[model samples]
Target: KNKYALQLDLVKDLEEAEARLAEVEQKLDPVGDYVEASMIAAASAQFHNVVAQLRILNPNVEFVEDGLDEDKE
Candidate 1:
């Protein structure tokens, strides 16, 4: 009987711990999403900035699709 009671108490504690972990994860999900979004936004801005710098450095360069043909090379 004592063993069964101890086991029940342990099970209850485990359940409470799991519930708390779940709540904490739920709270952190939005923060994770915001960080991910921020990284993506920063990367996009950097890419555009690089493109702009490249254009300034080579204003006369024409952008052609598929680039130079291998046969022409």
Candidate 2:
């Protein structure tokens, strides 16, 4: 089995997924009265989920945005 190729594919997939999640968060940005509290919470949850996945992919990777609780408050 070509383990290197498999690893490369996995890395590519993770990068793409991260990009898509970021785009979702960007789209969810509050805009006037069209935004709701529930939507903000959902976006926050998705962002945390992505951070968790990234950690799983690379245990040594450190994310500054993962400390989002302080920012949210």
Q: Write the per-residue lDDT of candidate 2 for residues 3-58, one digit (tens) a residue.
A: 99999999999999999987877787736334476767788888889888998998
**lDDT for residue 1 in candidate 1, whole number 0-100:** 68
> What is the Cα-based TM-score of model 1?
0.45
Model 2: how far is 60 from its true place, Å?
1.3
Clashing pairs in 1: none
Cα lDDT, model 1, residue 55: 80
TM-scores of the candidates in the order shown: 0.45, 0.41
RMSD from true fold, candidate 2? 14.2
Say which candidate scores most in lDDT: 2
Error of 1 at 3 (Å): 56
Candidate 1 CA-lDDT value: 0.75
Stretches of candidate 2 above 4 Å error? 1-35, 66-73
Residue 46, model 2, lDDT = 89
